[model samples]
Target: MKTQVAIIGAGPAGLFLGHLLKAEGIDCVVIERQTPDHVLSRIRAGVLEQVTVGLMERLGLDARLKAEGLVEGGFNLADGERLIRIDCQGLTGKTVVVYGQTEITRDLMEAAPSRGLEVIYGVGDVAVHDIESDAPYVTWTKDGSAGRIDARFIIGCDGFHGPSRKAIPASAAREFERVYPFGWLGILADVPPCHDELIYANHERGFALASMRSHTRSRYYIDVPLTEKVEDWSDDRLWDELAIRLGPDAAANMTRGPALEKSIAPLRSYVFEPMRHGSLLLCGDAAHIVPPTGAKGLNLAASDVHYACEALAGWFKRNDADAVAGYSERALARVWKSERFSWSLTKLMHRFPEDGPFERKMQVAELEYIASSVAAQAAIAENYVGLPV
Candidate 1:
């Protein structure tokens, strides 16, 4: 197979990039190691920053999202007993959309074919060759047969665990990371959210968050030790812990049901210095990862796709190498900001094992400042809603 650009991964970032490139009249193909069913079945965060929503609209893919997604105007920061509300719309004139990542992937997958985009799934032994040269090609195997795609550029949207990042030589990339001592044990249930807005709590025990995917579906999480296992948490036990951490009011109003999905996700902050090496460029989780505290993971992916599309389009249309040449730096600038936001939020909301009484007091003081000061709230709102792409 031959194409102008080859995209590795069928996640939202790759799919969105392919759709955007096709709209720009650029030929592109997506390669994935997972089946479409497997991709769509994975559960992920739902909060959509304003910019991400705008991109979906630009792609003519926001009808379902606009109708079904919950519009969140604000969120709450709680220090166990007291809740501090940050008015997102008031501070930034923007609101986030609560549309699951799975839905976004489904929308892109459904729209790809109609837009003349191509994708190959269930492949093995995927590798990149001659990425430093003007011409780059990708190879894989499917059903005991070898496959190859010769393209002008190869994009790695394959995520943190994917092969794309590993293909980049270690000498060409500088890695930075911080693995937190805790993880989030989350559950999805078919029950209305206890509150209209998401509530993030910093309790004596740990951290807890009350969120929702829709009007009737609730998603909640509690901070847990890295050594904890999901099997260690029963539905009843989890609920008891959540209610205690959420405080009196929310706990009293909270309803519980059988969990549809449950899992433990470790918190981490990771990034590669430059997102590009030769004709092989990385996007989204392939390049960096942020803790879920700031809800920046999927949003960052969308922004990366936007930048990639712009860079590729500029390269093909005007023979301008500037955008392509600077893609890494430009994308890294935004990525670092998000990482800071996620890191800050994580620190503020979670109780670290190393935190002394002084550190806990500091966290409380910071939350108090954010609650009392308009300037502080605005800063949090601006970053939470997302920085410009």
Candidate 2:
């Protein structure tokens, strides 16, 4: 196979980049190691920043998203008693959509063929070679046969663990990371959300969040020790913890149901500097990771894809080499800002074992300041709604 760009991973980022490139009349092929069914089975975050929503709109793939997604003008921050609502629309004139990342991937997947986007799933042994040179190619195996793709650029949207990022030499990159002490034990069920807007609660016990995928599907999470096991918590036990932490108001309207899916995900703040290494440009988890506190993970990926599209189109369509050379610097600026926001939000909302009384008091005082100060609220609101892409 041969193309202008070869994208690894069929996740939202890779698929989004492929769709955008195809729309730009730049030929690209996406490669994935998982089956389409397996890809869709992985549950992920549901918040949609404008960058994410706009991409779907630009690709003409927002029909299902527009019909099914819930539009929220604001979200809430609770210190176990009162809801400190950050009026995102009023403060920043913007709103976020409650739409699942899996849904976005599906939309891109279903629209791929019609848009002339090629995505190869369920491949094995995928690798990129000669990325430092102008001519780079990707090789993989499927059905016990080897395959190869020669392209002008090989995009590493394959994620952090995928071969693409590893292909970059350690000497050329600098890694920064902070792994959180706790993990979010999440529950997804077919029940209505407890509140109209998403709530991130900081309670005496720990941290909890009440979020929704739709009017009938709710997604809730509570921070737990990293040593905790998912199998240990029954549905009733999880719901009971959520009630106490989210406060009485949310608990009053909360609906409990059987868990459709439940799991514990460790939180981490990770960023690999210089997202581009020659012809291999990293996007999404391939380049960085943010805690889910501010719902920046998938949106960050979308922003990377936006830049990747711009860079690739400029190179292929306009013959601009500077566009490709500048991709890393441009993408990293926004990535670091999001990294800071997610880290700060995680620190404010979660209880650390090492945090003493002073730390707790500081969190309380900061929350109070945010609730009382419009400037503080506006800052939070802008970051929450997402900064300009």
Candidate 3:
């Protein structure tokens, strides 16, 4: 197969990139290691920043999202007994949409086939070759048969665990990483959300979050040790920890149900400098990953695709590689900013045993300042709701 661009991975980044490029009259192909059903059902991030919502709307994918997604004016930050709400709309003049990542993946997958785009799923032995040559190709096997796809450019939208990043020469890359001692044990329940808005709770025990996926389905997470296993947690134990962390008032609003799913995601901050190399470029999780605290993962991935689309489109139009040339530096600028925000949020909300009494007091003072000061509130509001696209 031959095309203008070959996108590896059918996750949000690759699928969205293909859709955007197709809209711009660019020919492209997308390949994924997982089946369409799996891609559509894989649950991850849900919160959509204002810029992400706008991008989806502009791309004509908002019809279903607007109908099914829950719009929140802002979120609440609670420190045990006290709570403060940061109005996203009031501060940033924008509201966030809470729709599951699965929904967006399903929508994009369903839309792709009709647009004359090809998406090969359940493929194996995927590899990128000839990056230095004019013709970069993706080689893989489908149905026990080997295949080759040649394209003018290849995009490594395959996420963190994907091979795209590994294909790059180590000498050409600079990796920055920080793994936290804690992880989040996230749960999907059949019960309704305890609160109207998302709540971030800071307690002596740990951090707890009350968020929702839909009206009837709620998602919640509690900070746990990185070494802890899901098997070690029973429903009663989970509820007990959640109740303690969420405090008495918030616990009253929460009613536990049969957990639909549960998983532990380690908290970490990582960034790979220069997201592009030769004819192959990386975007989204393939390039960087941020902790879930700031709710920037999905939004940052979308931003990466938007910037990459512009660069690819420019390359097609002017035949100048300037946009592609600067893709790394440009994307890294925003990526680092998001990294800082996510890190800051994680530090503020999670308890650390390493902290002294003074440090613990400082954390309380910071929370108090954010709750009492308009300026501090606005800063958190802007980061939480989103920055301009």
Which tens-of-lDDT digit does each residue in 118-224 have in candidate 1? 98999999998999999999999999999999999999999999888988899888999999999999999999999999999999999999999998999999999
TM-score of model 3 relative to the true fold? 0.98
lDDT string for model 2 (129-198, tens) is 9999989999999999999999999999988799998988999999999999999999999999999999
Q: After best superposition, candidate 1 residue 265: deviation in angstroms?
A: 0.5
Query: Which ranges of candidate 3 are over 4 A from the true structure?
Result: none
Name the better of 1 and 3 by TM-score.
1
Ranking by TM-score: 2, 1, 3
RMSD after Cα superposition, model 1:
0.7
Q: What lDDT does candidate 1 reach at residue 297? A: 97
After TM-score superposition, the amount by which residue 291's alpha carbon in candidate 1 deviates from its true location, in angstroms, is 0.2
User: What number of backbone clashes does candidate 3 have, counting pairs of residues 3 or more apart or in separate chains?
Assistant: 0
Q: Could you tell me which 10 consecutive residues in candidate 2 have the lowest summed lDDT? A: 113-122
Per-candidate TM-score against the hidden true structure: 0.99, 0.99, 0.98
Residue 323's lDDT in candidate 3: 90
**How accurate locally is residue 255 in candidate 1, as Cα lDDT from 0 to 100?**
93
- Report the C-alpha displacement of residue 206, candidate 3, in angstroms: 0.5
lDDT of 1: 0.94
Q: Pairs clashing in candidate 2?
A: none
